[model samples]
Target: MIERLPARAFAAGVVTLALVSGVVSYLMVQPDPAVDTTRVTAAPAEVAASASAPSLVTAAGLEQFRRDYRDRFGDTLLDEATLHDEYASIERAVPHSPDRVMPYSYRGTFESDHSPTTRPVGTPEFDLDALDVPLLARYLAGAPQSVGVPDGSVSHVGLGIDVGEATVSIYVSNRAQENGYLVLTPDGRVLAVRRFEP
Candidate 1:
């Protein structure tokens, strides 16, 4: 012989369990008010919007972005020249730290005065000190030709700094159409050739 609960008692117990689960789920989904949440753009292509932003260098926003970066990752040294491009030099920032286990990247036209957002990418792989603004400029000067873009075509370069590697995208286009881009290393090595179908 076994003892069983009445139907009404069983129904009440199920209802209480369901109510508790619902409340727990709701609490878990709510964001903590103490944390600062910034929007992270997943793709490097999304950074193209920075091109149209103001060209002025706002040190305040840039500094705040750096501070935010430090708060999140505890990174004290940032290498800014890594993101330099001849055309859009003022619209980029690259914050790097060797102490971090995972590599992180920030998105925004940081120099143009917008708030910076970050997302952890993957494991570290790049040599942090390999390139500077002058070196990057030299590579950009020759990137269009190496990628087979026309001699007089205009180009926009954006740098994506992964934890262990640096991916430089050189977007080229003529007066008529989009011509895709070239993926290059910080040292001018051609890593990939991307083609756009129009």
Candidate 2:
């Protein structure tokens, strides 16, 4: 009976320790009520939805954005005039070495037309004319199936001009998540394909 008593006492001690530890752990992980989380509490999905991404990657798209801006606030640079995504800028070749033409948002002056954004520049230019639009259309249509993302889930399409090559970045759902970009050349050549599973 004495031995059983000791065992019971030991079991009770263990149970008490466990309950205390669990309570401490739970309290440690809980968010502080005093902290303001209003600005930082956006869910992944909500953040994705709220993120500003340009719909088009061409010069025409740039024109559209400018037109929209003009329609809303005439001739004045507003807070929304900023290009949230740097990838939205298209690289165009200029005559001078230190002067490159790009959109106003991408380090360029606020101009309705593509204007020179001064930078140490290069020879080969992003050939917008050489882009195989028909081929790109077909590939983007099949990108969901080919890249293993949800069907018809193309969320954003942006352009990036790197090393004088025109590359397109396509986001399936949320670009900020584990899912990455489907990078392709303007000629419809696949550069990199990344997909999100969860």
Candidate 3:
């Protein structure tokens, strides 16, 4: 009995430690401020149907985004007027989500409309005046080193935002075909875009 009591006490201590650790880890993971809570509502008393992404970005909206994305950005780098128009289109179509964004990918392919891919793998850290998208903008504005481009490349072309049935897509291209992926809020702030090859 004495031996069993010791074992039981040790097990209880381990269990308590594990529970506390899990809670601490969860709390430490700061909640993203871009998650949309506006869609949350009490289920109507009449019908029973609730199964979809909390935020419903429409097909038409995505289409508009695609259209806006048509013009390649990096070529001349969108002039202020063009950027304003692009922003206006986005503003009209997609209302900003009140919730925090949890990092989304603005993925697409970039070919012509841009310089040849020269940077093979590693290019020394430097700044590029890429596109006007939040991610690219943030890059040029703050973290230029965190960008993907071929050697000698200075900017990326901006393709409009495209929303597929499942994904919202924003395409940009530079010397590096796959320049980077962006984490954007509905309000159009680029949380971050990490440049990589692949």
Candidate 4:
């Protein structure tokens, strides 16, 4: 008779074959079908829809807003003389015309001669009508000026005006600490205005 293997050896050989077969079968199979790719798309339209609409404040309106804001907030925290000086500086920085007509509807003329050097702490209300438009526009366009809160102070003053249909913003440096101004139209319409202390 031929020689036979031991029972334990035969059983071990069978188990090894079964394990190899299982691994091979697993490797041959395809990936699962759960993944979905239909949701991807360009997001620009969605982003645009979510953004806030632009404001429609005009140059004239901006001036009025500044006046109202000054009248409302000036005395609580601004030196009158300092405010006038700041305005003078702004006037010097911008181009002026004798006719006082700004190129842009939102711009206004700035006058240094009439600027006030000292305002009573709580005397006259802040006047938007007094703001020089050309100077104000130039300032908003990033022209440098010394105005708002002083060097050591943390509070700074600013102006917000609406001209035609666009709202313009102006910031005064803490070092200058002067008064702020704005111009607005007659309709009393406003879009937006923001202020910060620096």
The candidate maximizing TM-score is 2
Cα lDDT computed for each candidate against the true fold: 0.35, 0.38, 0.24, 0.24
- Please write out the lDDT profile of model 1 over residues 15-85, one tens digit for every residue: 11112232221001111344222111111111122443311112222233345445654553332222222
**Per-candidate clashes, comma-separated:** 4, 0, 12, 38
TM-scores for every candidate against the unseen true structure? 0.37, 0.42, 0.22, 0.20
Ranking by lDDT: 2, 1, 4, 3
Instruction: List ranges where model 1 is wrong by over 4 Å.
Output: 1-118, 121-129, 132-135, 151-154, 162-164, 195-198
**Candidate 2, superposed: residue stretches over 4 Å from native:** 1-102, 105-117, 174-178
Ten consecutive residues with minimal summed lDDT in candidate 2? Answer: 1-10
lDDT of 3 by residue, 92-180 (tens): 11113222111112223222232222222321111112222332232222222234334322222223322211111222335545454
Higher TM-score: candidate 2 or 3?
2
lDDT of 4 at 160: 24
**Top-lDDT structure, candidate number:** 2
Q: For all the candidates, what are their Cα RMSDs to the real structure?
A: 24.3, 23.1, 23.0, 32.5
Relative to the true structure, candidate 1 has a C-alpha RMSD (angstroms) of 24.3
